[model samples]
Target: MMLAILIICSQITIPLPGVPLTLQTFAIGMIATMLPLRDCLLIIFTYLLIGSVGLPVFANFAGGLPILLSPLGGYLIGFLIYGLITSGILGLTSRSSLTICLANFLGAASQLIIGGLWLIPANHLTLSQAMTIGVIPFIIPGILKLFLVVIVAQRLLKARLLAR
Candidate 1:
């Protein structure tokens, strides 16, 4: 069910220059908060594997190895990294809103860093140019997503709709 939600979220794309804006990070945040660390990693890895095998599970319904080889590929891999970090944080910390918010922020930062680094070599861009396109535009939206994730996860936990 969570994997399906992620796939749907991944399809909700606003195409940008190289990386398309999607609800993936938001869904990832929620998944990391709600599921156990091993389960969260499994879901993320499964999503990546499905997309890598050409199942149209990526942004704009893109799939296959080519999608994984594209400039935006690192962001896809970043999802796994983000899930790992967020899940680890959730495991170690209390499930307060602040904790979730911090975890999501850190996860977003990791994604931005990895994606920016990959963009530099893949797109033949300078660090400034990569940051300009890959990281800058996403920061605000990422924060907004973090806020939403924190609120929603808190509510879900309070309502007993989601596991801690």
Candidate 2:
């Protein structure tokens, strides 16, 4: 069910220069908060596999190795990184709203860092340029999403609709 939500969220995209703004991070945050570490990781890996095999499971209905090889690929790979890191944090600490918020934000930061570095080579951009186009533009929106995820996850956890 969460994997399906993630796939649907990936399609909800707003295209930018280097990367598209999608609900992927938000969904990832929720998944990390609600699911076990191993399960979250598996879902992410499966999502990537489905996208890689030309399933149109990516933003703007794009898929296949070419899309995965694009500059935006890092962001896609970043999803897995985000999932693992957030899941690890959630596993090690309390599943309080504060902890969830912190873990999700950290995961977002990891995504930006990895994506920014990958952009340098894939887009033939300088480090500063990559940060400018890839990371900076997304910070505010990412924070908003993190906030939303924290709130929603907390509610779901309280309601017993989601696993801690």
Candidate 3:
């Protein structure tokens, strides 16, 4: 189910020059928030592995080693970092609203930063150019996505409590 969500999220994209905007980070944050660190890692890695094996699972239904090694690939790597940090935080500490928001924000920021940095060399872009195209464009949207992830995570937790 989570894997399906990830794939679906990837398909929803707004094209940009360097990196297209997608809800992948939002889905990843939710997965990390809902699952243990290891499980979250497994899910993220599985998604990447499937994409690496030439599945049309990435944004715009495109996936291959070329996509993984493309300029936008750092965001994919950031997804792994995102799962680790976000899931590790939720696992190591209390699962409160504050923690959830903080962890998700950190994960999102890390992803954007890594992706922006990757653009510098991969696309022969300067730091300013990378920030302009890669990082700055996503800041506001990332925040919105972070809030959405938090809300969904809280609701899921509440539903689970109610179920129990």
Clashes of each: 0, 0, 0
**How do the predictions measure up, each by TM-score?**
0.95, 0.95, 0.98
* Clash pairs detected, candidate 1: none
- How would you encode candidate 2's per-residue C-alpha lDDT over 1-20 as one tens digit per residue? 99999989988988886688
Candidate 2's C-alpha runs over 4 A off are: 161-164
Candidate 1, residue 110: how far the Cα is off, in Å? 0.4
The prediction achieving the highest lDDT against the true structure is 3
How far is each candidate from the true structure, as Cα RMSD in Å? 1.7, 1.8, 0.8
lDDT winner between candidates 2 and 3: 3
Candidate number with the higher TM-score (2 or 3) = 3
lDDT of 1 at 42: 98
Looking at model 3, the pairs that clash are none
